[model samples]
Target chain A: DAGITQSPRHKVTETGTPVTLRCHQTENHRYMYWYRQDPGHGLRLIHYSYGVKDTDKGEVSDGYSVSRSKTEDFLLTLESATSSQTSVYFCAISEAGENQPQHFGDGTRLSIL
Target chain B: AQSVAQPEDQVNVAEGNPLTVKCTYSVSGNPYLFWYVQYPNRGLQFLLKYITGDNLVKGSYGFEAEFNKSQTSFHLKKPSALVSDSALYFCAVRRPRGNQFYFGTGTSLTVIP
Candidate 1:
């Protein structure tokens, strides 16, 4: 296990509501990423942070925003929840190098009604 | 664009029989390959990775992968299968010096008792 924790294991909310998921890592890795997993889509990257306050958009960054204020905490926010945003979210951390394998948190299951 | 592909959506093998999951990648420059397994309702677990050196890479849970650069494939294989080995397997690829990783849709493996 990689000392990674994801808060709010499960949540169900109505459309147009705001939703935020948190990912905390004990390991002081230099990179953190947020991804959504759906049936047949595998895992799609939403956003990533290379360092404190340094972030970049991923392939599917639309409708989602992320902030990394500190080295250990990364937050993913959905300004307005939509039914299409319902999916299992996962957070992963890796060392600075490209060859390093990523360590993942359990994940957050979110559903929009 | 850099990408990974798992040709099979599902694979089934009887207990004690040899099992294999196929993975092929397309990336510019030297690519880093990795395999991960995910149990139901859990995060992705690192299995094995091929960064450099030998073509055969051994990973967790008695699994090994063969990296064939000529074929542009990294296939996961186990000598014998177990019922507990059933899970979703994903293949990923990352380009050299790149921070982002592209993953496959995932292959569901079912090892029957």
Candidate 2:
């Protein structure tokens, strides 16, 4: 348990609707990451933050956005939900050092109808 | 580009039998390899990682991975399988200083009782 909490463990929304998932960590980790897990696709990074107000896009950044205004909170938003965006989203935190392993939250399962 | 491949979509093993899940990766420069396990409806948990040092790396839950640079592989192994070990396993790769990691498609491991 890395002291990470993901809000809304499960959600169902209609297509074209906006949705935001929040990740809060008690540990003062320097890096936070958002990822989506789908069948046959493992876990793909959506976005990541290295520090407060410092964020970067990942390989699967399309249709998603993220923000981190504080070290303990990271938010991922789906501007317009689609059926393809239905997946399990996970948040992870890690320290700022080489050989550090990332610890993950339970995850948020989002469904787009 | 850094990426990992899990050749098997599923692996089945009997209880008390040795088990292995294959993983191969391609990356520029020295590779930082990792293994994770995910239970149903849960987030991925870090199992082991190979950053630098010994080729054989061990982690939680009696799991170990052998890093073979010549083969470009880091296959996860366990001496004896347990029913509790039935889950999805993923292999990931990252560059030494890269911000993101690339993951394999994942392999479902089933341990028969």
Q: Of the candidates shown, which would achieve the greatest DockQ relative to the real structure? A: 1
Residue-wise lDDT of candidate 1 within A1-113, one digit each (tens)? 99999989999999999999999999999999999999999999999999999999999999999999999999999999999999999999999988999889999999999
Candidate 2 per-residue lDDT over residues B1-113, each given as its tens digit: 67789999999999999999999998989978999998988888999999889999999999999999999999999999999999999898878888888899999999999
**What's the residue-level lDDT of A24 in candidate 1?**
98
The C-alpha stretches of model 2 lying farther than 4 A from their native spots are none
Model 2, A1-113: lDDT tens per residue? Answer: 78999999999999999999999999999999999988878889999999999999998999999989999999999999999999999999999985688889999999999
Pick by lDDT: which candidate is best? 1
Per-residue accuracy of model 1 over B1-113 as CA lDDT, tens digit each: 77888999999999999999999999999899999999998999999999999999999999999999999999999999999999999999989989899999999999999
Interface RMSD values, listed in order for every candidate: 0.5, 1.1
TM-score of chain A, model number 1: 0.99
Runs in model 1 deviating more than 4 A are none
Indicate the residue-level lDDT of B22 in model 2. 100
lDDT of 2 at A52: 98
Residue pairs in candidate 2 whose N, alpha carbon or C atoms collide under 3 angstroms: none
